[model samples]
Target chain A: MSKVPADLRYTKSHEWVRSLADGTVEIGITDHAQHALGDLVFVEVPEAGRSVKADEPCAVVESVKAASDVYAPLAGEITAGNPQLAAEPEVVNGDPYGAGWLMRLRPAPGALAAAALLSAAQYQQLLDSEGD
Target chain B: MARQTPLFRLHQELGARMVDFGGWAMPVQYSSQIGEHHAVRRAAGVFDVSHMGVLDLRGARVREFLRQLLANDVARLKTPGKALYSCMLNERGGVLDDLITYYLGDSWYRLVVNAGTRDKDLAWIRERARAFAVEVSERSDLAMLAVQGPEARAKAARLLPPAEGSTALTLEKFVGRELGRWFVARTGYTGEDGFEIMMPAADAVPAWRSLNSLGVASCGLGARDTLRLEAGMNLYGNDMDESTHPFESGLGWTVVLVPPERDFVGRAALEPLAREGSPRKLVGLLLEERGVLRAHQRVLARDAAGKDAGEGEITSGSYSPTLERSIALARVPAATAGRVQVEVRGKLLEASVVKPPFVRDGQSQI
Candidate 1:
């Protein structure tokens, strides 16, 4: 079973969101997403200065089997993108929650609170409902 | 639920990640696909390829029947146990499947075909065999295991009976012979020295366990695909199918139109095309930049003025673990040459065209 941290928020598309001290949010794929994708060989994260809408494709993660898109969970302006992933993509497979975070974003006014992100329990339930 | 092979339970016991392959439950990987690929290149690896179809043909007219059925001349297989690779084509010159035929005796020949196309191939072969009175027998009771690498044969031979083990050591390449209850062939799909052992289905589990005990890495279908791509071998469904012929699929050499008198199923249709050049040609592409290549991606060929010259498609592409870079087999226009670009994720990446067999004998070839 994949781990779902109670402190984080998730989306139906499998991106996890963590609010930060500087009013910014960190984003990455869930453990379940990485496991389903097997070994990741390449990753293309969105650039910093780009404005992305909620539920829009903003990044790409490719495994040996196939490539998948990473959707933005909330309407936000990208502040920083993961730099280490370009040189070592497998870090996403090894530590998806920590060093493998894909990007950082500054949400628009009230966007984080208004977004329909799932709580940890709700995300776990979503994963359980869609069994492999 | 998909159909399960005899080794299905063993695969599950090994904690393999199972997926549906051509309506059959098969393992895509046990742990790391890259690790399994390296094991086959450096040491040894074993694959349970029991899903592949095994057919036994018998009758006094078997050779004559095959001559008209296969693209390669079966008369070349003069020695018993010798093998010949050929493509079975439709009357329209389109490839139905590629298979290996082993001459076991005067009236007996064994063929191993792709698992996905077995049903269609059998229907076609049986319908044609009626004229020559050839009997087609499907050997579903047998299981096949491919043990491959530089050390694969030695480790596998240790498990056979004492006398058979000695005989296996001397078995020549591309030959298969019955030893005790097993038919061992010195052949494999991976570009490595190995043996494909076929035995009674009941013995499959024990043999697999014994090989695991001998430290042969159990590989899944994912690794098998990368290994064969690096070896420059073609996959039946991906490389060519009912809509494409052998000439444009890098298999023109496998077809023999030399003895013009000898006729085959696709000969009449292929003769005219042979006189004229094919429009497309399959070649290897080496990515000059960072990224992964995948099947069905458009290949953009350019002229000296950097204008659109022609467009091709990647038939099979993946990250090659041996070369630590991306490689692919593409069917570009015959006139396409020099530098090309592969479109990936809405961006065109630079690449170079080269001959295939990208890596051979555990070494880089290009």
Candidate 2:
């Protein structure tokens, strides 16, 4: 079973969100998503200062088998993408929720509330229902 | 529902991720694909390739029939236990399938073909065998395992009886012989010294367990694919199919057109194309930049002036664990050489066009 930390918020597409004290929200793929993707060989993170809408494709994660897109969870202006991922993509496989975080964003006013992301329990329920 | 192999339950018990491949539910990976890939390249790994079709041909004229059926000259396989790799072609010189033929004896030859093309290959062979009165029997009661790496042969040899184990150890490369109830061949798809063992279906589970207990890592289709790609071996449908011929598919070496009078199924059609070189040739590409190369990615060739020389397609590609870089086999214009650009997700990445067998014997050849 994949980890669903009780403190984090999640989206149906598998991104986890952590609100920071600086009024920014951090985003990265959930453990479940990383496990499903297997060992990551390359990661293309979005650049800072880009505007993205909810569920927009903002990054790419490639495994030996295939490549997949990571999407923005809410409308926001990008603050930063993890610089470590470019040189060591496998860190995401080892520490997906911590050091492997993809990007941070400053939400366009009230976008987080409008998006209505899922809680840990709701995400777990979704994963169970999907039979993953 | 996908068909299951005899070792299906074992694979499930091992926590393998099952996937549908060519109508068979096979293990794509037991754990990390990269780990399994490294095991094969550095140590030993075993794969259950039971889904591949095994056909036994029997007749007084079996050798003669093969000469007509296969693009390679079966006459070259004069010694029993000698093997020959060949392409089975359609009447129009299109590749039907690529297979390895073992001349078991004077009246018997065994063929192992790709799982995806099993039904089609069987029908084609059976239909052609009618004129020669050869019997084509599908040996569905058999199971095959490929144990590959530098230490694969020695480790796997420990599983056999004393005399037979020594015999297996002494066998030369590209040779196979019947040892008691098993047929062991010193042949493999990966560029490593190993064995491809065929045993009765009932013995598969136990054999797999024994191999595993002997410290042979259990690998799946994911590693199998990457290992073959790094070794520069071609996958059947991905590299070539009914629309492609041997001359253009990097398999011209397998086709034998010598002794001019001897006729094969696709000889007439292939002769003219061979005389005047094929328009497209298959070559290897080594990505010089970041990002992974994948099948069907557009490959752009450029001339000295940076003009668009031609456009080709990647046949099979993946991140090569051995080389720590992305490598691919591509069908490009015959004149394409030097450097090429691959379009990956809308951005063109530079790649070098080089000779194949990117890694051999666990070492980078390119």
TM-score of each: 0.97, 0.99
For residues B1-366, could you state the per-residue lDDT of candidate 2 as single tens digits?
998888999999999999999999999999999999999999999999999999999999999999999999989987899999999999999999999999998899999999999999999999999899999999999999999998899988888998999999999999999998999999998888999999999988888888888889999999999999988889998999999999889999999999888899999999998899999999999999999999999999965556777999999999998888899999998888889999999999999988999988899998
Instruction: Kindly list the per-residue Cα lDDT of model 1 for residues B1-366, writing each as its tens digit.
Output: 898889999999998999988778999999889889999999999998999999999999999999999999999998999999999999999999999999999899999999999999999999999899999999999999999998899999998988899899899999999999999999998899999999999999999999999999999999999999999999988999988889899999989997898899999999988999788888899999989999999999865556676999999999898998889999988777778999987899998888889987799999
Which candidate gets the maximum DockQ versus the true structure? 2
Model 2, range A25-130, lDDT digits (tens) per residue?
9999999999999989999998999999998999999999999999999999999999999989999999999999999999999998998799999999999998
Clashes of 1: 0
The C-alpha stretches of model 1 lying farther than 4 A from their native spots are B303-308
Model 2: lDDT equals 0.94
True contacts kept of each: 0.50, 1.00
Best by the TM-score measure: 2
Q: Rate residue A4 of model 1 by lDDT.
A: 89
Clash number by candidate, in order? 0, 0
